[model samples]
Target: MEEYEIAIIGGGPAGIMAAIAASQNSSSVVLLEKNSSLGRKFLLTGGGRCNITNQKPIKKLLNIYPQKNFLKHSFFTFTNEMLLSLFQDKGLNFIEEDEGRIFPMSEKSSDVLDILTDYLDDVVITYNFEVSSITDDFIINDKIKADKIILATGGITYPQTGCNIKNYSLTSQPLTDIKYGLVPLITKEDLSDIAGITLYDVVISYKKSKVKGNVLFSHVGLTGPGIINLSNEISQGLDYNLLENDPDFDIEIAIDLCPDFTREDLKEKFTNDFQLKGKTMLKNYLKLFLTNNFIDFFLAQSDLDGEIQLSKINKKSKNRLIENLKRFAFEITDFNRDLSKVTIGGVDLDNINPKTMESTLIPNLYFAGEVLDLHGPTGGYNLKIAFSTGYLAGLSASEK
Candidate 1:
């Protein structure tokens, strides 16, 4: 068996970063990827443009993950600005879009992938290599020996990308609670007719939890970053107990169509509109606040006649209309059937050092990326975690 100083498993951002960092000073390193090509999933992020990382301030960037304190060392070591600079230093230009999302100037994920892979230089890349098992000494498919190994195999989010369903530490490590995060929800509302209707600046709330973003009507259900955020928060066990007994609990989230305006504020607006334009058709007045399809559907839900004059509506009916407009509820049956953005839980943070990402339980066993239990919502935060931790792990593992 050919032994190496370090072997980084999985070729995603974390593994690739690990290889780069490990080989910085001519340290022997090998990257094993099961896929025929590298970064198949990386090419799918941010609609193929690849939201490289957020350009948020150091303060905001540090608090993005659930284990915020656990990642303090890594985040500060390889910050958002540093991550951006790393790419820019390589002559790769990027553009800052909405929400501080940075993307390649070419606006193509392929370009981003090219830049990342180019950094590997002389690092050994073994494609189409799958390690069937991992032991104390490190073995790969009964071939190469990686004395010191960094497990960067991502979770089973995009299984098509070669992520194994088996949790590597199920037997030894206790906390490997895996669930999908940052995925679009499968809602109970059938807005097929109103599909493609976008509600800007809406607050999607499930009980005490809430997220604000544009909500898009998908044929299957609700989608968009706002809904995906709620899904991530929910998968973290925030509202997971709603299904404890039944295991198929139907949860409903309230969509505040107008987040800036309060329920009382909307009531006043509707009441005043009814008084001033009493002769105006209710449908026409509603058009100011809602989409035509929404007005049609909401008007029916309110049990009020859209064709009738606004002034003709009674006080009780007027209150009902205000409630429907303010807190429109939608049943979330399940998560997206299409693809899960990130995997939620992983090897517990307690078992690994925050500074080095090296396992406290087993010597020389390091972990980085989603496998480390550090994850966040979409828009480049998760990728940052992968890169930062991988850098630390690789640098630390190379040490004597």
Candidate 2:
């Protein structure tokens, strides 16, 4: 049996960091991964550009998480500044783009992975090592023994990236009822003609909760940051069984294309446009506010004619158009779990010690990454959590 000071399972961000932190001294730390290479899923983050972390201040960053208080210690231990400094010290430059998402200056996720693994020169990394079960006796793969253990197996989001590990009782929660997080929403209404249209500065709402950001009109429904965020909220509501029971859970999503304008404001704008171009087609006038493709589709929903002259437009027609422009409602039928950015639920936080990422029920056993029940919106928040928790777990295990 191969014995080591530390045995870290699942080589995603958390496990890698755990191994790195544990192996800082001459301690024997073995990182076991089911995949052939490390950071397989990490390569796919930020549309393959790798949003390494956010550049937000620590206090602001904490607000992005579900349990801000729980992550306070870990974030304080290894912050976004610490992460940036580590990579910059390793020759990997970063660039802050839209939404304050920090990415490698090279825009290559491979470069980010290289810097993370550079410190693993002396560590033992066992690829294709799928540990079936972990025993209290420090047994893994029914062969190895270790003084401390760290479980960083990610949640079941991308099976291709090896998150769908099975045949083992790794997490105390087990995360079976997997609902999609940060996924595109499916609408009952198909805006196929204008599916590819991208709208900036729009407000999307489901029930009383609303978020304002960019929205992408997909053939099935809506996507992008705003839509994806609402999906996460809905999924959480479902997990807590709040959807069916809550009287306000209508599942009807509203997109305010002209969020900056009130209904009266839009009405006035259109009324002024009508006066400016009296003989022009309503569709032509609407082109000033919306896309050419959306003009026809939006007109259909309002019981208005695209060919209707602005001069002939009535009060009722103007009111309907304004309403549609302000609150274009779509009945969200479903969201694709397979296409989600990550899984929402994981090992329950109640069983894990937030300070050390160690299991409360099992001594010397730590958990990190998506394996924990912590997730955030689709920026670089998840990656930051994974790295911070893993770092904490590594330090705690090494000390023990």
Candidate 3:
């Protein structure tokens, strides 16, 4: 048996960081990955560019997480700034994009992976080592013995990338009900005509949750950051079984296509345009605000004619148009679990120590990343959580 001070399972972002952190403390660390290579999902982040972290202040950054209170210690211990500084010290420059999203200067997720792997020089990395068991004595697969074990096996999302929830029962701890997070939603209405159109800075509101981001119209429904973030909020308390059994289940959401303007604002603009361009066709005049592809659809939904003169528009039709532009409603029916960016449920947080990332039920056993019921919205928040928790788990394990 190969014995080590620390054995980290699952070579995703969290496991890799755990191995690096443990090795830095002069501990003999071994990283086991099920895949042939490390970071299969990591390489696919940000469309392969890899959004590493956000540059928001620590206080503001913490607000993005649902489990902000539980993550307070780990996030403070290893912040986005600290992570950026570590990469910068290794000669990897970064670029900060909109919404404080930070990416590698090379714009390659492979480059980010290279910088992370460089820190594992002293760590033993075992590829294609799918661990099936972990004994109470801290023996992994009855072959590798370690004083402490850190589980960073991620969640059920992206199962093709080696995320198997069934394979995560190495410990007897209870797992929470799982739900899809940051996934694109399939709407009841077929949006195939506007499939390729993208609405910028659109506001999607479900219940009290309102998220603003770019919304990409898909053949099936809605996607992109706007709808994806809103999907997270809508998926709360919804388990896989409930969703699977209820095909008719749907949630109504209102999308503000013109978030920059209110109903009155749009009405005022329409009134001025109608008076100034009385002879102009409604379809031609609409080109100033909406795309040509969407004008016909909008006119049909409003029960108005595109060929109608602007001055010929009636009050009822004008009001309906303004209302539809301000609040376009849609019913979200389902989301593909395989396409979810993160999973909402995992090893219960109540059984884990927030400060150390150590399991309260089992000694010397720690949990990190998406395995611990922690998740955040897209644009680098989830990756930040993975790295921060992994670093804390490894650091605490090494000290023990």
Ranking by lDDT: 3, 2, 1
lDDT digits (tens) for residues 26-104 of candidate 3: 5589999999999999999999999998889999999877789999999899988788888899899999999999999
lDDT of each: 0.80, 0.82, 0.87
Q: What RMSD, rounded to one decimal, does every model reach? A: 2.5, 3.0, 2.0
Off by over 4 Å in 2: 165-168, 171-177, 239-250
lDDT by residue (tens digit), candidate 1, 286-378: 888887777887777568898999889888888877787778888788877347788777788989988898888888888999876778887
TM-scores, all candidates, are 0.94, 0.93, 0.94
The clash count for each model shown is 0, 0, 0
Residues 26-115 of candidate 2 have per-residue lDDT tens digits of 369999988999999989998889987887899999998888988999999998888888889988888898777999999999898898
Clashing pairs in 1: none
Candidate 3: segments with Cα more than 4 A from true spot: 237-248
Q: Candidate 1 overall Cα lDDT vs. reference?
A: 0.80
Clashing pairs in 3: none
